[model samples]
Target: MSRFSFNQITAKLWDLPDLVAGCVEAGVGQVALWREPVTEYGLERSAALVRDAGLSVTTLCRSGFFQAPDWFDDNRRAIDEAAALDTKVLVLVSGGLPAGSKDLAGARQHVADAIAELVPHAAAAGVTLAIEPLHPMYAADRCVISTWDQAMAIAEQHPVGQVGVTVDTYHLWWDDTVLDRIARAGERIAIYQLADWVTPLPQGVLTGRGLPGDGCIDMAAFHAAVEKAGYTGPIEVEVMNAELWERPGREILDATLTSYRKVV
Candidate 1:
């Protein structure tokens, strides 16, 4: 339980205060927050709420969409938010190709360049920018970084701790080469997120993730890889499913814990 962190998106409908209290009651000591909710609840207030409750903010959910015109400023603010929340890791989801553009190579290069520009700020803030590689299916409209190799290539360009990769099960399970890469990642692994991939992916394919044990992913294999990599950080349960979100918050948390225990 010490290593488990609940990502807020897993319980998307839960209000902030209730979610905090629920985690405390459930003996959940860590949580990964999303920017929208933190901003809506008032950042400082949310930080104090978690801090006062003795909860650790594992990582800020995300702050990279290089395709946006204001990405630089937005990501800078995200770094400040992570620092304010007293978290050391900020997840980066490199956005997909720009509208009317099909230059996959160019889009990927821009993500690397964007990270280089942000590394200094991230280092100064004592935060690690975790580049998350989404599944290849999302490459066109969600994330261009679609493999462990691509994420590592960009992260390796920067110093360890300043830049790293996010190993997410739902996104990487289909890649036969991912487990070995994750095993060799070492300190380059910034955060480890769990979500299984269910079949008949829904429209948009964004919220079709299953809990750890509900799909075809080999959670044990991923666990072994991260363990071999010496990652002793919090393991976050970050499932995103439309049906799951319809349940009550506490029920969601309970279900997530059950699913996690079966796999881990």
Candidate 2:
């Protein structure tokens, strides 16, 4: 059976302990956390709590924002943290267009450069850099790595187990060639992320995602493709929406888990 987990980015505003507790209470067997939450409670403390709660730490939320000149230092810290917590994957959200820059290609180049710099650190820590490609709508300000093809290019260039792509359905459900890309990713797909895309897209880049079965994404087919791609990893539930947040945390958690087991 496939176990499901929560992506901390979806509940970005919750306190760290509360987030973990909610997931455990809602029967989530694992959690993918963000760095800020880890920083808040400290990695060791958070890891201990998660273990005490009988939950696995699936992966960390993200570690790559390759657009900054000082990104190296920050990435090293993230790697160190992941190592300490015994987490396996540090999901990398390749950064957006830098201010005043119209060059998407150039920004992508920066991502490549950063990955080149971080690979050794990540490899040393035995942590994988899971590159998460955001949707094209966020092409300008969220992530330049917008396709599995682009992510595969980076992974092949690096050729390290410490580097692969994180597949998020909300970011990629609309892709015409998704099934093919999923097949291509195969073993290199490090993380399988799920979230529903509702109509009337939200204004801000982050908070529009609906829960699985709450939108029109063919999630069952998506799961089939993921399984066919040889990825048996936990399917990470990552919903970022104002409506979900406004509802009780337990309710959202229950709904997300139910939808994944039933619809996805």
Candidate 3:
């Protein structure tokens, strides 16, 4: 990892301007921003904010909730937003099954088809639709793309520059075979995110992630595999703990840097 990026969700409560200043003070030259806050801060201004701070926007948080009715237009706009932010990678979290829908296979197929449709737009916008395989527990609601093979299957239909997979430790650590495949993924690996898996997950399973090295994942092994893939890109530390979010932004950045150094 050349630069450590502090993901916005890791400090969700932090204001965007304050986050930028804190990152600069912490010597973090990179960040992964979410769409909502970026939009709230105004797209052009958000881009200017990070640029003025001498920070790089690693990857836009997400776009692909294919099950949504307006996914087509929404994703295109998201692609444009990523371009506006000067980030090439736009992470896609393929939405899970539709409400009360039991056709899991159909839902998965829709995700593939939706991604295929978005490829040209993403390519035109100089963006890569990075498929993020959420953990299996999110299969029913958050994401249907829950494994490396599943994500790659859809991504392989397009060029690696336009479509690729996000290698996130919190989501992939349970899979023993993922590291080897990641080693061979080459250019298909678009972005890498870090978050440790801690036990006794909270309700909704969203804000329970631990910082790197604070849980069971062998982050060194992951780092080795990512390097083996010839990936020397920005590595984002994206922990979403409610407790961590409650702390002051500067304190969180300090702790995040400490955790990152321990694992890196």
Candidate 4:
């Protein structure tokens, strides 16, 4: 339980205040927050809410989308937000190829370049920029970094604490080589997120994730690999199931914790 971090998106419909109270009641001490809700609730107020409740924020859900024209400024603000929330890690979902562009190689390079530009600011803010590699299916319109190697290649170019990789089970489970690579990642692993992959993926495929142990993913294997990597950081359960979201916030948290216990 000390290592469990409930990613806020897992209970997407839960209001921030209710989520905090629910977590406190459930003995959940850590969370991974999304920027939209934080901004909507007032960043400072949200920060104080969690701080006052003794909750530790594991990471800021994401801030990348390098394809956006305002990527630089937006990511900078994200860093500030993460710092203000008292979190040390900010996950980056490197955006997919630009519209009307099919240059996969070029898009990947741009993501790397964008990270290089942000490393200084992240380091100064005492935040780690965690590059998350989404599944290959998201390559066209969601995230271009689609493998552990790609994310590590970019992260390795910067210092260890300043840049690192995010190992999310739902996104990386299909890669046969991922577990081995993850075992050797060491401190380069910034955050470890859990979500199983169920068949017949839902529309958009974004909200189709299953809770840990609820689908086909080998959660134990991932746990072993991460343990071998010496990652003693928060383990975030970040499922995004449409059906799951329909449940009450407390029910969602309870279900998530039950699933997490079965796997971990």
Candidate 5:
């Protein structure tokens, strides 16, 4: 329970202030925030609110879409935002191949190069760039970095704290060799996220994640690997189910805590 940090997306409709108060009430001391909601709430204001509440921000949602024309500026802004929130890790989602482009290899390489270029800025801000490998189902449309190996390869190119990989149970559960690889990752492992993998994924494969233990993933194996890697960071529950969002936020948080207790 001490390691648990409730990711805000687990209750997407929950207001920022309400979420902070809810976390304090629930005894959740850490959080993972998204960009849009934080932006809407105002950057410094959100930071001050969380700071005043004594909440530790584990990481920001994401900021890497290498194909975008303004990717550099956008990522720099994200770095600044993460700094403002007093969070050390800024999640990076390497976007899909450019429109109508069949060059998967090219797109991935571009992501690595883009991260390399952004390293100085991230380092200057004292933020670690945590590359997230979305599930392979999203490789064609959402993310090109779709495996632990891919994320690690890019991360290993930079200094440890300046760049690292995200360990999300929903994405890595299907890979048989991932456990061993993750155990060997050591400091290259950044934040660890939890979202059970459900079958018959919804369209676009974005919002159908199950809470921990709701789906068929062997979550215990993941925990063992992360522990073996010597990672003591926040364990964020980041499910994105539409049905869950329809429920009350407090109910959702309680359910998430229950699910987390069962898995951990």
Candidate 6:
């Protein structure tokens, strides 16, 4: 059976305790947390609460942002936090293209460099860094790693068993070679995320995602690919639409679980 988790991104806060409580109440057993909340709660405290509540943390939300001046420092801190939480994966969102720098290739290189620099720290902490490929639309501001193939190439540059990639359906659904790359990733498949995409609107990326069955993507195919790759991690629901965020938490959680079982 496929287990489920919630990405703190869907909750929009850095409070791991609150998010953990919500997940426990919903009968979810795992979570992927963002850095800010963990920083606030202290990694040890966050880990304690999750374990106390009988929940396992799936992965740390992210550790890379190469465009930032403090790239090296950022990742080091992320490794420390992941280790403290006893999390097995540290998801990295490779930085976006810097302003006036249309050089996508160069931005990707920066990501490689950062990962190379941080590998030792990650290994020492016993944490695996998982690269996350955002959709091409966020190519300019969010992440340069935009495809499974690209992420796999980056993973190859790292030492075996130290780095991997996170496959989020909301970002990979449009890719023609998603399955091919997921299979190639094999054990490098560290985190598998599930969310939906709706029609775009004026506000931003938030408007584009819907609940699982509400969208048109072939979720079963996507899940099959990950399973074929031997990925047995929690299926994380990471919806962040304004509508869902605004509704009562229980309603959103109920709808999410229903969609997960029925559509995912």
* TM values, all candidates: 0.99, 0.94, 0.98, 0.99, 0.98, 0.93
State the lDDT of candidate 3 residue by residue for 127-192, as single tens digits. 999999999999999999899999999989898799999999999999989999999999999998
Error of 4 at 208 (Å): 1.1
Report every candidate's CA lDDT: 0.95, 0.82, 0.93, 0.96, 0.94, 0.81
Q: List the residue pairs that clash in candidate 5.
A: none
| Residue lDDT tens for model 2, 134-189 | 88877887789998788888887876577888888888888899877787677788
RMSD of 3: 1.0
- List, residue by residue over 1-264, the lDDT tens digit for candidate 5: 888999999999999999999999999999999999999999999999999999999999889988889999999999999999999999999988898899999999999999999999999999999999988988987799999999998999999999999999998898999999999999998899999988887774578999999899999999999999999989999999998999999999999999999999
Candidate 1: lDDT over CA atoms?
0.95
lDDT (Cα, tens digit) per residue for candidate 6, span 1-264 = 248777777756335666677777778887777888777777778878988998878888777888988888878988888888778899899979887899998899888888888898899999999999988988999899988888989898877679988888889999998887787667888888888877654376745588787787789889888888888778888887876777666567677788889865
Q: Order the candidate numbers by TM-score, best to worst.
A: 4, 1, 5, 3, 2, 6
The lowest-lDDT stretch of 10 consecutive residues in candidate 1 is 197-206
lDDT pick, better of 2 and 4: 4
Q: Model 4 Cα displacement at 45 (Å)?
A: 0.5
Deviation from native of the Cα of residue 144 in model 2, angstroms = 0.9
Candidate 1 ranges with C-alpha deviation above 4 Å? none
